[model samples]
Target: MSDVNTTRASAPQWRDLRETVQRNCDIADARYAGNDTLCTYLLKMREFYRWERGLPYSMALDRREVGDWVVAREQHWEGLEAQDLDALTLGERRFDPFDHEAVNQHLSPHGLVYGAGYGRGARPLFFLGSLIKLEDYEGYRIYVVGQEMARDLSSPPAMSRGERIFVRRESIRRMVFEMIEAWQMRGAPAVDSLGRALRAYGHDPGNDESLERMVDAEVESAVWHEVGEVLAGRLLGPEWQERMMTVAGSRAERVMRAVRDHLADCLATLPALLDDAPEGALHFYFANLGGMRALLFPQLREAYEGWVKGGTLEELKRLIAPAREHWLTVAERLLREPPETWPVSDEALPSLCPDFSGRRLG
Candidate 1:
């Protein structure tokens, strides 16, 4: 892995990079942590604590210790909330935190992969990690990272900016582990799609080794979704970002994201997985589906059931066939409205895009 890391005598540079990334992450977290419900906030903090302490998934967290840490972390965030994001300084050069391409140009040679981008609610997120893999994908540079030195509460497994995609193997592993842990915590009922997926893989979620195996396979799943994002970006055109600005931080923005996510999956993600991914991967996708996405396309879930019962993928494929066009129509319809027409409500759903199933689309 010489190509992955040229980290011979770069300790000082590494420290500087970590400091900058962590600081930006703190500032962003301080500002947005209040947006989550108490349950979500605590769950996210638990993961953040585990990562910061470098705890193994098999180890049980001490509840009292975790509670104390959470209180301290929240206090720390209070101090950082008003702080402005800082630029990165490496030796004699300085770079804007969001200019990841230019920043990576210098950091890659030092075995660093840096990510800076906006996530849900337009909150800025930043992380620094050791570069694991770097390659070209359809004219985009894809950087896969492992062992993050710094990160925010929500370490999104993948992010795309312009044409660059950053895939975090470490983050993906943790998220997959969390999924299994959550299922196991609930006694893994048969009705859970994740439970079915785990059975299909012969995965024992209680066993960390098996969980890692699932992580290895699902990393490919995360990459496919990001590629689908690029594909969706092409179809939505650049105006989609402009549209996002109009609804940012509102319920309507969530709807907007859910619409694009469905479109992207139909265009690229589900197709790629159905063609080559393991049986469990498809189930895993549906299991993770929730929030606005699950609401916007309930028929896809029915299509999934049809596939499972009939032992054929044609039902799923047929549903996906019209998804791209259908979602685009909805997206464009939303775009046509004056920005003043929002904050959109449930009533806006039928007016802008009527609920339609695959049967109706056909």
Candidate 2:
């Protein structure tokens, strides 16, 4: 229950985790007995994480004994509410899974969830003694079970459930790497030109609201690292890594400023992504890129078709030339005459996102 972000580089050590679970389970078993839904939920959730990471979920507990106790005392079982879970009863001042606040305080930093997906009074008879072995990909199998538990803790209809975005960790990592490589291959001069265009188009680098909107913290970290590296090369020459690691004061600040400035342009040059910006300067530049792509990627699609089929970047520049021209045209117009609104109308959206209907960058 420490700050997960601070320790994200290391996953929880299993031996320590196992011991904690055993001690907690013994206390719950001694007192709560058959109605220990909270303890059961925690054990299963922890096991699910282990399953995802391809680790063993074994524990030193007798499942059959626990199952019999639950079945025999079924009539007296009572599901807990958030407040009921938060209260300490046995004078032990220990962490409990029933304590929704305590659990979320620990779990939120890791993007793990509990007590938010379900409504109260919906606890099912989940005796963990049955799950001795988990199959490969059992993480997906148990995800539904977790979802149902979440539903039980869900708020009433009057309260709005916030929008949730889930990106597969691997896919985002791929995207980050692809983007970095693509920028690097484009060469430093071209990258610098694009950065200048972003400044001319009034793009601001200080804004990072989009970073917060991304669902996964690891993806955000990777994006920052890769983008920083890409800009570092352009701004600080071949010895950028040495400069970044060893230098400080004004030198470092200058490099960071240049990187942020270049990032503004680089981001705008790419096909406008789905959630590129929230408001202010970036919103229109992004829309313009999308519009440019809408106008250009299709026309160049046929020429690039051979490259895609053959899996070669040999002719990528030939394809990018037209797209870059179109992008600059839009960037110039945006600089000269700003639009009243973005994503225009459906009829006008094509001007920003030529393949708006398809919504697929490829």
Candidate 3:
């Protein structure tokens, strides 16, 4: 039989294996609910193994499949042993599911009879069951199916299992967009702060090169076109044809204006505190300002807050003065900085204020 035929013959049997793995994961999830830290860690390990290798179980106890499963199982067991499981309750009965002697006695002539639980042969199987679970079974399914598909095609497949699992290009695009959405939601404050710092130095935050780098060209086109339609709905009261014809520039400018208005609203809430204020008052003012900064730059908020609460206003200001200067330089350079030089391409922003190559007053 050809390799393809061999894989085809094996495919039907794989379903039962996947179902068993899923069922096991579900059991693990139920058993470890209160002990979430251990549960999550073990579940993630199972997920990683499933993704990296295939399922850690076999449909038949044939020497090849069973031996492979045993090794994978032992590795998982050793990992679990390294963790603290004192708080876990196995309900007064620690179950030994794999027994070597019984397995050995009942084996088919071609089958390997590993002992059930009591002997050396059963030890590896016993350890394997301790860590493998079905809670992350879907991920395992994806992993196994993806791996099988890839392995059947070639020794190392051209496209990854992730690509196959996420089939259609549109589906992959949607997944990427969802990832970007989640990231932005979590990092909104930091992004906003970076925008504010850019605007403070007379740079157009809307035209920020860093922001452009973060979004792919195709996505950018789709976003702005959607923004145009939304703006037109608000401005011209939602006539479909009129909205489609509205200039993109007009929509973009409106967005920039709205952003600036929102910033003005936030600035209005700031409480007055001067450099000469007492340490206590300075701390209060710093706390309040830090809160505003948090709304714009969440990543730096804790450190900024710590600096504020640590000492007198003068001392804090002196500590951050260099950073403030650096921020100014970065802002000024944003307009002239080559697109290739921006660190935003790597999904990171400068940790501190950074200097620019050339100075442009505007």
All candidates: CA RMSD (Å): 2.4, 21.0, 25.2
Give TM-scores for every candidate, taking all chains together and pairing residue i with residue i. 0.93, 0.23, 0.19
Q: In candidate 3, where is summed lDDT lowest over 10 consecutive residues?
A: 151-160
User: What TM-score does model 2 achieve against the real structure?
Assistant: 0.23
Rank by lDDT (best first)? 1, 2, 3
Report the number of backbone clashes for model 1. Answer: 0
- Model 3, range 54-151, lDDT digits (tens) per residue? 44322222456545754565554444443422211122433223332232222212111111111111111111111110112222111111122211
| Tens digits of lDDT, candidate 1, 1-362 | 12376353366747877888899999999999888899999999988888999998778899999999999998999999999899998778889889998888888887778899888888888999888778786787778888888899978999887788888998888888888878878988876789888888898646777777788778878878888788888877889887887677988888888888887787788999889899888889999899778777877888788777765887777667677788888778767877667435665554444355335653
Which residue runs does candidate 3 get wrong by more than 4 Å?
Answer: 1-310, 339-341, 351-362
Question: Best lDDT goes to which candidate?
Answer: 1
Candidate 2 local lDDT, residue 180: 29
Candidate 2 residues 1-362, lDDT tens each?
A: 01222222123422333334333333333333333367655443333333333342223334665455445433322322111232222223455544434543444443343322211222211111111111122111111011111211111211101221121233332232333234446762333323333333343333333322331332333333333334323433434333333332332223232333233233333222213432222222222233323332444444334543554533433333344444444433433342344333446544632223343232
Model 1 ranges off by over 4 Å: 1-3, 6-9, 339-344, 347-362
**What is the clash count for each candidate, in the order shown?**
0, 16, 19
Q: Evaluate all candidate structures by whole-model CA lDDT and list the values in order.
A: 0.82, 0.31, 0.28
Candidate 1's TM-score: 0.93
